[model samples]
Target chain A: MRNTIGEVAKKFNLNISTLRYYDKEGLIPNLEKNESGIRIFDEEAVSALIAIECLKKSGMSIKDIKTFIDWCQEGDETLKERLEMFLARREALQSQIKELESTLNYIEYKVEYYTKAVTDGTEKMVKETMSNPRLLNLQ
Target chain B: MRNTIGEVAKKFNLNISTLRYYDKEGLIPNLEKNESGIRIFDEEAVSALIAIECLKKSGMSIKDIKTFIDWCQEGDETLKERLEMFLARREALQSQIKELESTLNYIEYKVEYYTKAVTDGTEKMVKETMSNPRLLNLQ
Candidate 1:
């Protein structure tokens, strides 16, 4: 049996409004409407939604995702293009992971700095200071 | 000698507007203005900017960063709070990295799927199909 939009949203852990927005954006090409105009999701629609969510998580823009869906509709003819898109997204994700790791390193350093400051009962001795400490005193 | 806003922005790879916004947000507490009202960054201001940028990179919100700046102004009395903030930020960053890595894995799976499809000149055999293939035929 086909699932209602709400059912699909619950199954996928997505918001109903987000599913509606996807439909509005024409990303859910296989979505169907019943006699009373209620939205229904068949397997293909759900699969497409799964793919779209994955792409979005990979930081693909809506425009780019729309292009990917269009390519999916075009079938095997766009296989090369789809492959290239995934490759590019992988590179972007790698860069993001690297940058976040660097940020985490700095946060870790700060955590260590504060850990010592807390133990020492003052930041005066542990705090990093300007080369010309008088500049800090100036203001 | 104190550096002008533009000079500091160039050195730090930040936009002048962003530096001004930071000063406006009170993140750069020690920032000074010359007699002509031009912004000048002393060593203390530059150091605070560096810390603010690191916190921003770790995905701390502006309000949280403003609180941190206030805590810094309060000195050693807030060392424990600052430590807890960094600890929380580190956990958040770690979670983000894990999510991105998972996304990357799925993208890699798609890349492999497409690579084979491209080699075979068709997705018919390589494509993932719904258990009930008839659902795909419905739309």
Candidate 2:
């Protein structure tokens, strides 16, 4: 099943401009083109796009993603550097998860405080209970 | 000791313009000023700024943060609405954390793939071991 760039973009709910931009940015290198200059997304090209989505969601910048693509194109010699990059980004993502988990804890406090306030038809209980973090520590 | 906006901004490694923007946005509603109009941030004001930092880092928008602040100032009457807002954002944060965690998993796979590739001095080894997702499931 051959897929055109427009077809792949539609399937992924991505804008055509975004796919074109990714192609220009080297995130989609080795993209095949027909004699008529139509973009062709083979299985390998689709896999690359999926990898790009994973990296982008994990907060990698366009420049960094391009570096990764360059490494892939350059082949076996860059494996060590690629491993180092993955390990570094793994730590960054871990820290991000920790930060968001803590924010969840904070938001839990607000939810509890407001729930109590709504129950009493006033915020007095919430204010009185404010100093105690454990009151909202549902976990 | 009383602190100026610049001092507080420097403490947090934030730009002076950011603090001014927060003030203009009403995130710091009761900021005091000296006789000559130099903004003086007391301990309480500093705490407010810290709270703002927490919310901002958790992906809250300027408009939403302003709504939260307005709720605080509007007293007990806004408790229910505040509760709804907190619940909505709590769900949003939960989704964000889930997304990040999945990204971490994807990165873990990459790290494992590259680690083996580097050890074998070839990308062929990386490609062979790609089938079992559980092999790199560090979590």
Candidate 3:
């Protein structure tokens, strides 16, 4: 249930340097040191790393993740504040998703218009653009 | 109008090195050269940089953006293929948006659970966890 950093890196397909970077950033807590002064990780450490990866892929910054982990270690006393922080992050992500969706919709519309123009000929495309002032002078 | 790299960098709030980097990466094409071999950017170049910023924020890689620029320069002959590529990119972005949305939902759920636990006291929280067999073991 315990392993060296190298072992965990190999198992998780992460570079050893990334693990070291995370540790330096305070993203990992309760990291133990072996008799040889090497970092030792137990099952709980592995679970924490997995959680860190999840938060990272969800777009959480290392600083914010460090704060979240600190709250986790502090137990139920800080849970309400942690919950508010999590909800704020979730709302931010929701807005980001909405913005991306809107941009994607515009890109899709442009692609469709261009596709039709290429298939039906440039003359028709010009006429369509002329009829729709919004599509005028597209570069 | 024309501006030196330094002037452009100052006006745009970007570093001179970043402009050089963009030029080296082929993100900016056909940059005019002065008699002394210094780069000179016109209004169109500035507009292109703004467009590049828009695409970059939308998560498009510089290489893909270069290809898009190439297609734009080539005109209607490459229009169909360009449209197809844009459509494919749009789909990929839509999928990413969906993944972010799901992650946001999960975070929201966790936030609610933690908020209730923190407000209701740890004893009540432990009692609630007792309903779950895995958490019951901690009791």
Query: What tens-digit string does per-residue lDDT give for candidate 1 at A2-112?
Result: 999889888778899999999999999968898999998987888888778778877889889999999988988999999999999999999989988877877777788
- Which tens-of-lDDT digit does each residue in B50-94 have in candidate 2? 667667767989888899888888988888788888888888998
Q: Write the per-residue lDDT of candidate 1 for residues B30-125, one digit (tens) a residue.
A: 678989999888888878877777787778888899999999999889999999999999999999899888778778778888888899898877
Candidate 3: list runs displaced more than 4 Å.
Answer: A1-7, A10-13, A37-40, A120-127, A130-139, B1-54, B123-139
All candidates: DockQ: 0.53, 0.59, 0.38
| The 10-residue segment with the lowest total lDDT in model 1 chain A | A130-139
Interface RMSD of 3: 4.6
lDDT of each: 0.82, 0.82, 0.74
TM-score of each: 0.86, 0.90, 0.69
Clash pairs, model 1 backbone: none
Q: Which regions of candidate 2 deviate over 4 angstroms?
A: A132-139, B132-139
Candidate 2 pairs with clashing backbones: none
TM-score preference between candidates 1 and 3, better one? 1
Clashing pairs in 3: none
If the candidates were sorted by their DockQ against the true structure, best first, what order would they fall in? 2, 1, 3
Q: Write the per-residue lDDT of candidate 3 for residues A1-139, one digit (tens) a residue.
A: 7889899999777899999998888778889888888999887777778767657757888888999999888877886777788788877887888777766755666576777777775535554563432222222
Task: Kindly state the number of residue pairs that clash in model 1.
Answer: 0
lDDT of 1: 0.82
